[model samples]
Target: MFEQEYESFWKAQVRNASGQRLEMLQRDLTGTKKLLEAVLLPVLGSLDDLILEYEMLSVSGMKIYAVVCLPRLRTVFEEDSFVTHAEKITRDRFSFERVRARSVAILGYTYFPYSRDELEKKASFCQRNLFELIGRVGNVEGTGMNQLPVYEREVLRFAVYNRKPFQLKDVCEWLQLRKEACRQVVRELEFKGLVNAVGGSATRCHKFMISEKAVALLHRS
Candidate 1:
């Protein structure tokens, strides 16, 4: 009964704006808690099933799950097995990097209690910074041999626009480049100090973020 309702709710959400989904959940905290309690808590033991189900959802749906459901089910995720499963999902080439990154970020967010107000404030600040960085980078001089490659520029643009860290696999998938070629470009970016690896690993699954220095340099140019 509730499952049917949940499916309908999700379908309706698919038609709505991403921000609207978050806003709806935030507006009815009690109802959201009840829904999580009734539906999500029962399936906490089946992490694999949950992940697969979520995999079928859109990126916005995934973010909604993270922002709304995960907080209420924090204990389930804190389990070693669930954490392991999430790590595996992060490395899964089949999954979208944005979804994986959101899952990982939500897991981190679950460690402490935070209000909608707090989350919104942080998101706003990050978005502001990301746009500033993107604007500066877009205006950098020389599109020739001295400048960053088109692919690398696309990567920076994607990261800033999405406001999310991304893995090499994400780059390859989005840009339709070979894995090795994407890795080489990422390495070149790192070498030039335009980006930084999150886990300090050059491996494919590791996440990369734009460096503050790159933004500063672009802003100064």
Candidate 2:
């Protein structure tokens, strides 16, 4: 189907354009063809194939192709297998930022389907919870009965219930702490084996999830 569409588009361009404009259109078409060959062609292949092909392009190129290909590949995106792959890719530490963000945005639009105002309201609610948690923890001196800091304990509890890996921005939204402070706490949790960095990179936005140890501690508590 895509090949047929591309062929038609190519023929139309060849017929309608001339000179420098035709040359420029041909160049654009060539780039689009490369993108399709690299990324779109492996729709049913391993997630690694998609990621590798996507990384072959520049960030700006990624944005452009994502905007173009996503709509056309809506059915692919809607498939259960592809959705599972997309979720994993979205959390991959090695995945490029633009690609990860684009994948996440598309997934959110596909599955969650939220309006701008509704999204803002949910964000605000998360922020409020984070601020409240911070205040509550601040009022306490020592770690809870388990010797874990109040904040850490609460964060663990939250993660256990949520069962989803969360980025630093998500943590800050939920904890209302500065990024540095949130990062420190997360690192401490990681060191203690209470949480694991599940997705993204240290140099960029990363996600953390509660470890089995944290879940056990929560159960013990």
Candidate 3:
């Protein structure tokens, strides 16, 4: 469901120790994705919904260009643009300027410390929201999303991670599903009351979000 083919991280890594060693720092990728998919997508849509910053990789102070996945907002933005993003965690991994060049909006930086206390201390508004989001990923309480089919779970996870309105085109591209098939999935979610369509009746029904009922239940989860 993570869609490795859609993930630039796995597409062209050397796979030897030199490349694989960086796996220890996967939180760089995961955390970035979480922030964008959850906190930043809404503002980003208003800025540049047509394109995205996608995945980034900086290793040992060297800028590494990765294979680009075109025409979508990718989850990861691996940059060390500020003290908050990488300098706080480690040095010589990425560049703030290079990452900015690829970005639509300049979101805040995030530092994921191994210590919960340290993390809780420096969590700016963005980081605090992201921290709560991380909690929701692996259910704090089993809310039955586990019972869903794999594809349904993927879309639901996207909705939950987004915590905001989204479009079928975005999810379809992000999840690598055919358009019609994704519509069917959304239809199922609407029936289950996990999702619902949103828009004026005069306008086309193009926007959707996690249902408020489901959101209320999930917050407690």
Which candidate leads in lDDT?
A: 1
lDDT of predicted model 2 = 0.46
Q: What tens-digit string does per-residue lDDT give for candidate 3 at 46-158?
A: 22221123334443333333212212212233323345554574444345534534442332222222222233343345544543453345243354455667677677666
lDDT of 1 by residue, 99-166 (tens): 65565555543221233332334535433443543343454443122266777777766665655688
Superposed by TM-score, candidate 3 places the C-alpha of residue 31 at a distance from the truth, in angstroms, of: 26
Q: Is candidate 1 or candidate 2 better by TM-score?
A: 1
The sequence of per-residue lDDT tens digits that candidate 2 reaches over residues 91-141 is 553356446455545553221122223223454443333223322332233
lDDT of each: 0.48, 0.46, 0.48
Question: What's the CA error at residue 160 for candidate 1, in Å?
Answer: 1.5
Q: How displaced is residue 213 in candidate 1, in Å? A: 1.5
Q: Which of candidates 1 and 3 reaches a greater TM-score?
A: 3
Candidate 3 segments whose C-alpha is farther than 4 A from its true place? 1-136, 139-141, 200-204, 216-221
- C-alpha RMSD in Å of predicted model 1 compared with the true structure: 18.2
Which residue ranges in model 2 land beyond 4 Å of their true spot?
1-145, 201-205
